[model samples]
Target chain A: MSDRQLADWRNHALNLESEVNKVVVGQQTPIRLITTSIFARGHVLLEGDVGVGKTTLLRAFTRGIGGGYQRIEGTIDLMPNDLVYHTYLGEDGKPHVSAGPLLMSGENLSVFFFNEINRARPQVHSLLLRVMAERSLSAFNSEHYFPHMIVFADRNQVEKEETFEIPSAARDRFMMEIPIVVPNDDAIMEALVFDTKFHNVDALVNTVQPDVLQFDQLNAFSNVIQSSVEASDTLKKYALNLWKATKAPLDYGVKVSGVDMNRLVLSGASPRGMSMMLRAARVNAWLNERTAVLPEDIHAVFHSTVAHRLVFSPVYEMRRTEIAREMLQGIVNAVAAP
Target chain B: MKTMIRIFYLLLGLNVAPQTAFAIDSQNLPDVPPGIVTIRTIDPVKLVGYTVGDIIEREVILTIKAPYKLIETSLPITGYEKRYKGQVIGIELKSVSHTKKENKDSATFDIKLAYQIFTNNVVAKNAALGPEYLNLINTKDSKDLVKYRIPNLDIAISPIAIFGQVKIENNMSPLRGPLLLSNVKENKWLKVSIGFLALSLLGLLYILGQRAWLPRMGGTFAKTHRKLRKLPQSPEGLKLGVAAVHESLNTTASMSVFSNNLGIFLAQKPNFSPMATELQQFFSLSRQVYFEPNAAHGLGTNPQQWLQSFVRRCRDCERGLTPETSTQKSGS
Candidate 1:
């Protein structure tokens, strides 16, 4: 595509972002990152405390994309088959199989939201991993397709009981872990409660055109965006250094205040995580209408993109996030700019 | 954290020091002895008339051609009289010599001896205290003795004595040969050959494992083969096809307009999607066939006719939308 077409496509994406903004307020960072993840054709993991608008953000983003959206509440009893079909005795007193939310969306599914995903059992997580990785699912001995789908999962942080944490392999399948914090700004909070228009999510989401972009064309568009976005050596180096630092923080001069640097690292981000970081960064840069990546782009998405990928030493179990954040900052400071 | 770090270092240091010290101490020990030879022999000779506790004297002479010193010596005996028969009968070593170029040498030994014999259907005991001597002399002609013997050297003497109230026995037979030797040689080459055979078998197994026999036996090979068979023959074409499918599912323009727009987009973004060309073609065809109004006007129809024809085409397309076929086409 020409530069003008690229610009127009980016503008169109921004317009979709604005449409989502109408329904969900004060989550611009997450909203933008989510949009980037969508264009990258990658899954996302949302982590936050309770009542942080994660669901609302995901719902609004799905509406902005204008395709079939399916949401499944993750529970301890949720099974792999539940994502495919519900088996029960109907009013006719006969056992029947009906399509679940995942299949109900059919081939047109563009967005899949899994809420409180950690509450789901590992068997369910494994099934979700397959769908997210292959964009297809096996149900009743047949492959169910979702060519344009992007999986958005939210994990609850408050409770540990009966919750099965998603394994590293499954977490790596997601391109980013966007943290949805409660907006600290009193004005945004006040506007969220007092604004009657914001209260009606359905009405607000309906403002965008339905099926604005064809679901099938997304891959092509993503390709165009990816190929067009160039990353400078300096920014690429910064990202790589950050990834290395996650694995070996001491080498990058990252000092976790109360943790032993030598013993604090169990495993670093896997190769998959580094690749996902670059993918997400490229899309983020593309959305900014920049042909090339900047250090600022890496900085903007570094924490959410990389923090959860780090595996801390068991000794630092209680301070994982804090140590990870410190290590990331140290990496940014230590890596020399070009 | 500081305490933890200190403790971690302390544990590591402690764990490493003992092994290091042990290794150093082991290295300081002396090397093991090697190449010392040992020789042992058993000589069986008749003691025709000897009694228990008798003081018997004997001597043995050995010829020497070179100078050598005797370090140490031992004599082992078996087969005694009475209850001690087939056990240690006697042992006697008199003396050793260091000599140079000597043709003959001799030494004397003393021991107590006894014998039992039968005569006229009555058991009898015999005892003696005389001397039987051997003289070693260097000679060219000597029929009754070895060629190297020294004259007038009383090297061997046997003295026998008996003490007990017992009848004398005669004509007792002496024990025969089959005296066991103390030294036995080990066949190292045989052991080495067996080890080599075992090592060769292990090497063969390693080669087989490297060739993936183990994985094949575990069924991973068959699974991988099945996965590979699903892949598209032309990767580039398949990727393009997938990209085209993505585009078709996403776009809303008429068939001609969409194709034209896609063509324009492809021209501008030549390397777009990196998916196979067949996939691209399939995607473009699906988009054009499913979403757009057919351009029958160029051939002979209006927009309404185009719409109806498009609807019919869409129905046909829907019928063809099998997940199996799609997965097969994608080779996934």
Candidate 2:
């Protein structure tokens, strides 16, 4: 691609991030990381308490991109077939095989949302993993494609009953797992609760122009972002070390208070997690107009890129967040300054 | 009448002269030989003596009772010089001393002498020919004995006398009397000094050998020398070293991951291309060793060597890419 075209593609990605920020208040960091992942052609997993605007933020992102969008609420009864099609009889007594939400949206579907993804059975998760990894699904003797698709998943943290935690294989497929918390500031919280527009997800999402870019152009745009972005040796080692630290925190000089490193870490991050982190960091650097990645870029996206990838010891499951924070701090400290 | 009176005065002067002559003659008698020297009458003789004055001089003479040929002779001495004027006075008398008790006969004479008392020079002008004297005394046959010219003088001799018969014997054996006499002449202090010098030379040789061999035996110094030799020489090598350290420090930051992606692109070893063979090898080794179980265990005793080799290859890969061009290449 021409340099101008690459530049325009980068500009468009940054514009999308800004556009999402307008509707999603006080979530610039997550928005940037999510945008980076999108441009890098990787999926994301969002975790938060209810009413954290997780769905709204994803909707804003999809609206800014302007392409076909699908949202599926995960339930224990949700089966692999449900994501593909439904065999039913119509009111006219005619048998029909109608495409499900995942397939009905067609090849142009740029954003696929699976709300409360952990609520879905492992069968559905397995299917989602395949779709996310390959960006294509086979059903009815045909291969359906979603070449430009970026899957945005949210897991409900408050409830665990009947919820099946997404297996590592499925989680690894995601480029990052971002946590959407209740805004800490009273003002932001107040604005979120009292603002009538914020109460209406559809209205807030509709504020941006839909179908702003052609679906076919996104792959080419993402490729340009990847090519135009540069990452230095310092940044690369920092990320890899962080990824390794998650698996073996003690080895990286990270010690969580009250948590025994030897007993608290079941395993470190998989190589796939590291690959995802670099992909996301590269896109973020490109958005920042930096030919080389800076330490700030890596630090800005570390938690989302690495936190969910950690497999904690069973004894430390109740304090995963505390352990993860300690682990991350240890990693940050263990990795030398660039 | 006047001539008769002058002759009477002359006769008186001559009578006084005769009394003066008699007094001079009484004081000029010859010295008698010591009775101990005359009593020791053996075929061969041995004697030991010491110096008694600032300068002692003696003349010895021997008169044989029979027409006998000169036989072997010797002077065995300790801490004494046999000197006449400025020269060593070697044995001149045949069969001067010999042993008779053990038919294996031998002879020895010891004379303990000192330098002139008033001089600062204490070293003897010449060494006594004691060994030659012992050789002559040990010879058995009288026909083979050599005679020595005798000089007579008023000699002061010790009362002790040593005498024996001449016979053949092993002069060098420690059991022999000659060996004891020679050992006395070699001072104990001199023997100790010679021993110390020999020991010091051996110690010096040992230190030199250690210096020459330790490096070849792979000591710590050798290992350090090898490391210094292998250090990078080029600007690219220096850049890579700095880069590796920087990356190692910033391990936790996301920038490192991003940089690695750029490194991968810059290294350009996708599908193991020929130009980036070393990079491909390094990547493959890291993956196998890090990701595959038991790979480290398989490394055996040479883990450091394997690790060092891996690090070096990675450095080589890193150095091949210029920082400015690497960014451009990765972006492309």
Output the lDDT of residue B99, model 2: 33
Instruction: Write down the lDDT of every candidate, Cα atoms only.
Output: 0.59, 0.59
Q: Candidate 2: where is the Cα deviation over 4 Å?
A: B1-332
Summing lDDT over every window of 10 consecutive residues in candidate 1 chain A, give the lowest-scoring window.
A329-338
Q: How far out, in Å, is residue A109 in model 1? A: 1.2
Best by DockQ: 2
Predictions' DockQ, in order:
0.00, 0.04
> Against the true structure, whose lDDT is highest?
2
Residue B226 in model 2: lDDT: 40
How many pairs in model 2 have backbone atoms within 3 A of each other, for residues 3 or more apart or on separate chains, i.e. clashes? 35
Candidate 2 lDDT, tens digit per residue, B34-145?
2211112221122223222334322222332222212322333333444556554432222222332211222222223222212112212222222222112113343233
Over A280-333, each residue of candidate 1 has an lDDT whose tens digit, in order, gives 778887886556665556666777777787877677866766777787766755
